[model samples]
Target: MINQIYRLVSPGRFEITYRDMSLNGNKLVVRPKYLSVCAADQRYYQGRREASILQKKLPMALIHEGIGEVVFDPTNEFEIGQAVVMVPNTPTESDEVVEENYLPSSNFRSSGYDGFTQDYVFLNRDRVVPLFTELNNHTASFLELVSVSIHAIRRFKEKTHKRKETLGIWGDGNLGYITALLLRKMYPESTIVVFGKNDYKLDYFTFVDKKVLINDIPQDLNIDHAFECVGGRGSESAVDQIINCINPMGSVSLLGVSEEPIEVNTRLVLEKGLTLFGSSRSGTVDFQDAVNFLQQNKEVIDYLSQLVTNVIDVYSIKDIDSAFEEDLVSSWGKTVMEWKI
Candidate 1:
């Protein structure tokens, strides 16, 4: 099998090589079906992270979201041909996993071991969740991220003040769309508003309850809750918008990973008695809920496939850079790589 390592601090080229791993003990071999390139992957790929933190986490493979089919297994929990989603992070019960109420476990898979960009990957069967018969490979592949969005909305529901408070979303990317869609399902009577930079993304904005451009946020619009999905240098401005748009005592869920530190109005936060949460990956309970939801709603699987824009072959590992560069600006959804035998 071949694997590519992302050597931090360096840019321009990838370190691709081959390796052999026998399924000794409980290890199983997964045939890589899809590996999604997330925004974070690009940040790490471009060497735009902090240098000290980079040194501490150096010499790691650069994939976090991936899905594959079982090719070989020692554990009977998964079948040879069963499709599965890879839960990147391995969390321990004792660890303080939450950051501002979100789980930030450091044991993500791809960063430590050889990632899912290989023809075949060796992993413990426990690290995977078998995709049900209803969902196809493409839909199954996105379960990891969708699960997080589902979990975030559920968290918001727990702290909700009203049965149907006006909701606002700060980004219209895949996570924002998924979060809005799930929020609609959870709160049928709620008015969900989506805000984003792109106007064309709003063309297919029927998934969410309502859509608006960043500039169109009505001055009178005081959302009861908001979610931030765009995390970069400008993410702080989005956070400001969310804080300003939400009514007094309204909550904001911070789900984005910003390369730059976010700035917020502390005085307003205190004056409004606001709640701010950092939501990340799904917990064990939420993970199960996501799988169950997918199993029950086959129609959503079809809709999710539309969000996938590019599916490249991992055989062209050398082309990973180009694959990401093309989709860097215009990509509305996900770009994944398929490893063929």
Candidate 2:
């Protein structure tokens, strides 16, 4: 079969090309139903990444956050028309101590190879996760991101100091919102405080114990732990503030992607006895846990639904560009694409 794939040949340029797909002994074949635009995807589309990195990663399919329907499954692991979330992390080798995502051999879709932008996606059974029928397509499309948050929180729980009375999350973006929400759900007794610059965006986080402006934080305010979701140019300030406000022996989970290297207050970190950890792409287990978390916590679904600001349907290559363009201008919320092709 010839698969119609949309590839980013260069910055601000895309092309549709056909490639032969061999279905020999393939367990599952999925057709994308909905796709979500992530900040990383936008960076690739707009050439925000370093030129050297783009030169090696371009001309590849660009979306890793997507939901699809099973078109064919030889083993009948999933129903023919069942909905499933595509797992982008492909691990060829694994170690007992190191997780799949941390493995150097893991090939992440949309990073080094083709993603789910093709007309049909062929996968091994483990690469696709089954989703509940009631889950909305828009929410399911971004399950990858949710799974990433889940993974980060899991790491925090395993490595952080036992004191969990107050948790501070820095950044008012979508990632910050999701991390705060998950923290509340996972640790109901702990107070979750969000720190960010945008008043309008911070307003949506009413479920948190407190939302404080980064510039206006009270000197007396302190947190037992902190998660730094602020990446990019603002990361230095966020990390410094976290270091100052967090309690001694506190742990910091870093989730945001920094385009360029930023300086950290290593002296403060050492003096405070802080343990800092970074979480990147997630694996199959994290994906499953994310779906189960959503299914068990029905109310979280309603809260997450608020993150969908723009829903655009993509019927052609031009629509793909338009969705990326609109996502660039949207101040808050996630831009989801209803895959029509």
Candidate 3:
């Protein structure tokens, strides 16, 4: 099979590359239906990463968050024309305790190799999770990210103490919004507070119990657990604030990604007896859990739909560039490309 892959050969440039793939393998071929732009994709597109890193990662297909339709299933597991969310993490080794996403031997798409920008994505037998018709395709496109949130929450539940009275989510971005929303649904009795610098962005989280400006948090306020969704330079302050406001022996889930190491108040963390756990890309299990969660909670689809900022149709390489450019300037939400290319 000859597949056409749209790759980012350089900053602000994409090129069409060809690969002859074998269809006789155990893998199934899925035609990407919808793809979502993530913050990491923007960093690669705008060359925000270190020159050496960019040099190593460029000339690679650019999107890991996407849903596709099964075109060819040599494994005979998935039905032809089935709509599924593609899992991005590919693991080479199995561990007894460690998850696939945390395994160092795992290969995640859009990181080093090709992603879903290809004409047809060849995925492992377990890498595709079927989506129900009730879930919107636009919201389903970023199921990779939603799976990450599920992974983090699952880890948090395992590591944290029994008490989840007050949950604090820092940063009002998409991750924070999704995490807080999930927590609200999962822990209906708990008070969820979202802390951020932007009122406008924080306003988007209307469902949360409370919204507090980072600088204006009440001194007496304290949370049983916290999630730092603010990545980049903001991660430092967000974690610091969590250390300060979280109750003693509380748990903090680190879902944010930072390019460089940031200083943490280790003394405070130790003194407070805090357990900080970090989660990143998720595996097939998390993807399946996310699928079940969406199927069970049909209302979540309506809430997630608010995050779709743009749904551009891409029929050519030029449309891909335009979608990335448009996503770069958008103040909030996810940008999805209806993949017709």
TM-score for all predictions? 0.88, 0.98, 0.99
Q: Poorest 10 consecutive residues of model 1 by lDDT? A: 1-10
Better of 1 and 2 by TM-score: 2
What is every candidate's alpha-carbon RMSD to the true fold? 3.0, 0.9, 0.8
lDDT ranking from best candidate downward: 3, 2, 1
The digit string of per-residue lDDT tens for model 3 on 215-271 reads 998999999999999999999999999999999999999999999899999999999
lDDT of 3 at 60: 94
Poorly placed runs, candidate 3 (over 4 Å): none
Point out the higher-scoring one by TM-score: 1 or 3.
3
The list of candidate 1 runs beyond 4 A from truth reads 1-9, 18-22, 92-106, 112-114, 283-285
Question: How much lDDT does candidate 3 score?
Answer: 0.93
lDDT against the true structure, per candidate, is: 0.71, 0.92, 0.93
| Best lDDT among the predictions, by candidate number | 3
Per-residue CA lDDT of model 1 for 14-79, tens digit only, reads: 665556555567877777677787776676676667777556665566666777778777757667
- Which ranges in model 2 have alpha carbons more than 4 Å from their true place? none
